[model samples]
Target: SLDGASDNETKSESGVPEVPVPADDTPEVLNKALSGLSSRWKNWWVRGILTPAMISFFFIIIYLGPMVLMMIVLCIQIKCFHEIITIGYSVYHSYHLPWFRTLSWYFLLCVNYFFYGETVTDYFFTLVQREEPLRILSKYHRFISFALYLTGFCMFVLSLVKKHYRLQFYMFGWTHVTLLIVVTQSHLIIHNLFEGMIWFIVPISCVICNDIMAYMFGFFFGRTPLIKLSPKKTWEGFIGGFFATIVFGILLSYVMSGYRFFVCPVEFNNDSNSFTVDCKPSELFQLQDYGLPPVLQSITVKLYPFQIHSIALSAFASIMGPFGGFFASGFKRAFKIKDFANTIPGHGGIMDRFDCQYLMATFVNVYIASFIRGPNPSKVIQQLLALRPDQQLHIFNSLKAHLTEKGLLPLLEEAA
Candidate 1:
């Protein structure tokens, strides 16, 4: 009778059907399956092919058109750092992370001034001169550096004193890392420290390459679980990546041969065709014989270019890069985030993009600051001054004319 009435009213109710809510375990299981599927698809489809394409585009700009590439690199650093600070601070929500970020914004501004040698008063002047009272050595210089640091420290300490220990930790940890990074990179780029830059660059590059390669190889070949924290990873892939990165470094040293490299040529040394990091700018900038080979022979007489020590350095980089990535992965897991934010379809967030860069910066900063930069500190100022057009052509030409009028070409050339 229930099934035999008019079409609309004839349907059975199936004894009061129930709307089911899955058990707690069901969601967890589904999440795992979904994550696995997503990881597979993203890595296979986007990261694998697209990463190379992006890198190719990047290389094209870097080689054929560099100004934009440099700008992009600098911008990426700025943006990534901002995100790192943001995510790192998220854990300190109760401790006023937003305020800390605001302070950082101001700190960056002050740092720009300190490095660029610009001041608020400079805007009022039509032309800045050597005598501009606002130069680094001026009376207000120490005052400014002190004030900036003190302000930051006070804010940091106050956050802790207010029971914002979490934020305090972030601020404290980052401050140290910041000090380390700035000290290292500034010593190389600004000071032109060759050895430090080399050790740092090699390690940082190796580590970054290791991270990328691990992600790649693992996504394709990984089967065994490497760590519970990052379930998608595998020991096989890790091993492959570690070696791959070392090889990548060696190859990079080989491919980018015409530029600064760790492996000097045979003419540079007679140690039987190995690799070495004991490189000199004179060698790198000039041809093989007159430039680098002899400089290396004078340094590492016994070790080949690809000696044990050289491998050690590359190994450090290859390892550290993945270590950094693992650290980032742990942080992400704690937050239960898929990626830092989805800025890249596959790459996750800005912090995700720079997780390796952070470690690389640290690696480069350390080596350069410790041994490679050597001793000179004032070279940057001298170089920048000499590089100035007013000091280079105009001033030199005028001096040359006076010297020539005095009939002193020998003295002029010697003085120059």
Candidate 2:
């Protein structure tokens, strides 16, 4: 009887046909269904459980090898690039500019080619030199990148419609800005990873630790807002997250330092046909005696140098890293959107998760270049090996002469 009544209800009472409802699989229906869920349940399901579970899965992959981690970083870079470019497209939707999207993606390709080429040349010099095609490509990578970019520029110029010229230029600027923000920072992140998995792992972990602790503290006792850009961020949460991150960073560094796999830099070993992190750990990873300051002298505090550096890294993650998220918030406010996209169910887009991370990555790269990186003798030796016999001999003689001039020949000879 209910089925017969439903069939009758499908038609108007006057024997006119009724318009059928859209299917349940339609975007509108799906969105409505999602919107029906409570915010608390969605947030808890995604943020509390799914997010951590996903992070743990990623950590397992990272533990397996840096190459896997690098691939993950590349995927994130592409997603972030997509998110930002999509935002730009939406913002400038009124202007129908030709080749804007095409050119934006082309430029991304050019930039990634340049950056990844540099990384491969720098870190896998031996592997590159051994392959005839790779060796040629490595020699002229920048020139080729420049040529590819110029081709895109020419295409953009040729495709420019008369009335939408201004709009095209505006989009060009938008695309470049997105590239800088998304692609450039991701390059630095990979650089940090190559330096040592610890460099990559610790800073990222600190950021995650800070984010979680800040939210916990804020949810329980947030009274004063930290910034207008991010209203939910509170002073109490900031302070709590800071201390927690510092301790977490120190502990993480200590544990990672003990393992050569974590502390050693990722290098390609042609002989092994794979990348390896098997070298002796750096001074930063090794334990070192440090005297306590006057405030802590009474407590008999002695610690490794890395433990001290961990505090600095955590401070950046706790303080400056959140500004990146604040900037992202302001950007979303400008766009009048809730999140970058609905890619991650309740956690928002990949860009939302990575906004703070990109800034942290840039900071870590600069910190490494300024403080952590030194004249890597192994790399120099590899380069020397790749050179012609004449060049290698010249360099060898020059190095020997310099050592003699510096009165270090006896020391070197004795050691040899």
lDDT of 1 by residue, 152-235 (tens): 767766655433344356566764565344333332232221232334345545665777788778877888998877788798
TM-score of each: 0.57, 0.87
Stretches off by above 4 angstroms in model 2 are: 1-45, 294-302, 386-388, 411-416
At residue 214, give the lDDT of candidate 1: 82
Model-by-model lDDT, in order?
0.52, 0.81
Q: Which residue pairs in model 2 clash with each other?
A: none
Worst 10 residues of 1 by lDDT: 10-19
Task: Give the count of colliding residue pairs in each prediction.
Answer: 13, 0
Model 1 segments beyond 4 Å from truth?
1-39, 64-73, 88-101, 111-142, 151-205, 260-310, 368-416
Cα miss at 403, model 2 (Å)? Answer: 2.3
The digit string of per-residue lDDT tens for model 2 on 59-149 reads: 8988778888889888989998888788777655544557778889999999999999999999888888889999999999999999999
The top-ranked prediction according to TM-score is 2
